[model samples]
Target: MPTAEEIRRRIIEHGLSIRDRVIATMPQRYSLMVEQIRSIARSYRGDFDTFLTNLSSIKGLDLLVIYTALLAVLSKHKSLSDEEILKIGDSFDRHIYDVFSASKARRALEEAGVEKEIANDVISGVVKALNLINNKYNSPYLWIAEQRRIERFENSVREVLFRNEGGNRVGRGVKLFLRLFIHDTNIPLAVRIAYTQENKKYILHGDMYTALVTLRSGAFEDVASITAERVKARVAKRLLCEAKEGGARCKDVVMRLESIRGLVRYVGKISGDPIVYERGAYDIGYRYCRDLKCEACPINDVCKRYTFIKLK
Candidate 1:
């Protein structure tokens, strides 16, 4: 098992990685974007304490679409540009998918001069997959002790993709939905006690959830598999629960987030960033695993699964 120190280092490192990308265009205006969002949250509620009262009330489709698009791109061994995403959504919002087909979707992209074979990234594939999941389970409050129902939902996602000619990898799609819902704090507990017991030869296989926990845990030198790290998260979750962080959800939220820095100055306390593992796990896939090569990944040195990228 990896020590907590290693994991904490990785969390900071991954946070830095994301921070770098989100503000790459400016003169690297460095800030933990959370602090900024927190500031917005604070002022909106007239104070931090009041914000927690309406944490779930401030809702909209804007954050949902952005999050869903990220998941869609990471769902396969493919990537999508912002323009490609806009075209797909625009086509749909304009009802162009009324005659939806691979060719028709392809034509729309072709008309836009997208020369790549983007059937999966564009109209008929990932877009449709996302819409299906959204329509079937469009809950801002998605969660389950209903393992059978969740399993049925997962199976239906696969069935939808099979019929729509989307990528047939059910786990990837299911995990992506889980990531998003958990991210928005819909189902936090599932991610913890999260991975299956069976270990894969590589981290990305059956253990992607814990693999993420390991990777986001910047100091992940000692862990054997993602499963090991997940075990760690389960332990951490208990510590959090015992500590009573963020009330029942183990993460307090603010309708209006303020920046008081320490726990005392704020409106409420939260469990250390809700579902950081889920968000980070999918991020590793989206950012690194798609075009996976040892040279391209920053944590490549520590990931034992790959020995040589430039194999002759």
Candidate 2:
């Protein structure tokens, strides 16, 4: 097997290659999405109440926030496929299209095959968050606009996003939800700021966690050495700094690591952004590193298949 350092190098190379390729020739992947996001951001300057009353279109920003709240909660369950998640989202969307009803939201989620407790958790937590947004911040858009620091802003968003109707805490998906919410190109303006300033603080999602731990084994101080999410994220960021400083491909490596860390989004894909360009080379339709389709994986020769799972 290749050494861990070699494996890390290979991962970085493949990720950057795919990123560059997509940016160069796949305008269709992000161009339209970027433009649509720009239009949405430009068209809406009103506060949350007006946004709720005047905008009932599916494409409206309020709906996006609501949908993201729903999807982010559901996304915590790794077993659900993307199609299944979308189905659940659609069901909730239909029920609470113009107005949000907690009972209806829970029922729709349960009917769409979500577990009872999880459905309840999703609805209760999201409803509380939405209510807080309306009552305190006046609007989610305004909440975003008023923030100065990224960390404080993220914390504020997380506070509302984690709200539960019964005053109980929701599960550990709050940060994941925040990441997904801010990264969505539908709010390209926010993404531009967050990604540029704080991308280093992002934790690798579960999908890329295995690949990262595998590659880092025996090479350097392992991020798995810690269990705290903040500590682990700091370690991961430090590793990125070391890799960028020690390697010839500094900028490229950091960008690729960012891609793997769930900080970059291809038009339709999530998490597996580094390999979004893979197709004929792998002969597999779509492969995320977590899929462990090593036979078709471009980095298989160096990947160690090792895994550690204490990440948040």
Candidate 3:
């Protein structure tokens, strides 16, 4: 696995000609923010639990104020350009104003005898913090959108497995296999050999090999029985085709597979079939191989699965 520093160095080395420094910094920045958010969420769990319990004790407007404050602090280091900041501020303002302008929220505030001055103060504080472009470098909305997209993709995978009657054990096994394979930074030599000869893409082979090993040990006993040469040839063919056809870009294939892995896991857990899980992976791999366009994969024609692929 590449260390954070190593990843950064690699990015700098490879991205010198990419023009947009922000684009190059995206992966690192996102990693940092995710780590920070996890830390913050863990630290404030007690507060969050209490807030949820005392929901009625706080006004809706007060909750919005707190949310905006958290967003400001969390996004302080995003280093957004002036235009990006303005767009975010505008989104927040419009969203908040629309909520407040609603009949239900307005009526509730009025019934509570809330002072307009207090509401104005809260909104103004949020707006001021949002407008401070210097400290606000991140795109919280984009992060949220990405999260939603991932969730939707996972749901689609689950639906497909459930509809197909794939067995539970196979699905579960495949899901686990996928998770292990997809996010690994190091590519295994065996997987690289298989992928390059068959699929044509240079994937992180280490991850794929680990996944195969796990599959053999766990659900795919038949696969375990298969000769190593046969397995290598099969995988290589699939990967080579995908690479040549532009279904799997060497740069982003790992990330795209990670998303697909998450979907596979979700479906496996829901459907309770190991074969379903394996089939899901094969379907994804094959679909990518057949369609040059990642977005328009042939699997969609028959399998009906949807997933978000991060575009460069």
Candidate 4:
């Protein structure tokens, strides 16, 4: 079996490989979204209010605030795909302000064909998210751009995640939004990626979490079989922390996280547009781990699962 350190190296190496491949060829929906945001940013010419006004026009950004609140309550265990999440957001975009109650939102999502668990989870998350954002910033769009200090931005994200009841200050959705928002306005990739990495908390969801757990489990027995999302996230964070502390020159952790999340925005190497990897990476990773298809997995050789196969 590969040593834990070796496993860590392998994961980081594979993650970097995934990052390059995906960044080179971004997904259509995500690429389009970046383009659209950039187009608006270009038109606005650095007017904050106008940029925000047009930005909130996106359901994902607006819906995100509500969900961030929900994430505080439910935690950041995303069970939906990016497509599904965006579709649901679009459905509610027409009248999200008009419907504030869980019952109302749940019923609407159900009518729109969302599953019961998903509907319940989404509604539960947003109600508190809306309250928190409203009491503080009054609008989600403002919340994204309100804090000038990175610490303040990180704090709000933590507040949203912990349901504003107070707990460890760590968050993801807002940061993800901030990433896209800043990148759209032409923030340097190094700056944004640095912030994301410095912030220390990775943007995670179900598939990404699962893939990490599987990789970790295959290589390290200590963390193997961890199913709790929060616990799994901590383990994932620790791996990167160890790598960083060891002075490993592994590629950007944030980009690797984005690669797993199935979309990334980087200053394009050959073009003016940001490179965006399409959604489905997490799905593919999840499936490989879920089905135990270790032999055919792209990173199988680095994974301990391959070690098992070798012994057999």
Highest TM-score among the candidates is held by which one? Answer: 2
- Residue 18, model 2: Cα distance from true site in angstroms: 9.0
Please give the ranking of all candidate structures by TM-score, highest first, separated by commas. 2, 4, 1, 3
- Count of steric clashes across candidates, in order: 13, 0, 30, 6
RMSD of each: 16.4, 11.4, 18.8, 12.0
Give the best candidate by lDDT: 2
Clashing pairs in 2: none
Q: What lDDT tens digits, residue by residue, belong to model 4 across residues 172-223?
A: 3443433333332322112332233332322322234433433333433333
Runs off by more than 4 Å, candidate 4: 1-34, 38-104, 112-125, 147-155, 161-285, 306-312
Each candidate's TM vs. the true structure?
0.36, 0.54, 0.20, 0.46
Clashes of 4: 6
Ranking by lDDT: 2, 4, 1, 3
Clashing pairs in 4: 26-276, 26-277, 27-277, 27-278, 70-125, 72-161
Off by over 4 Å in 1: 1-5, 12-77, 81-108, 111-152, 162-174, 185-275, 281-312
lDDT of 2: 0.45
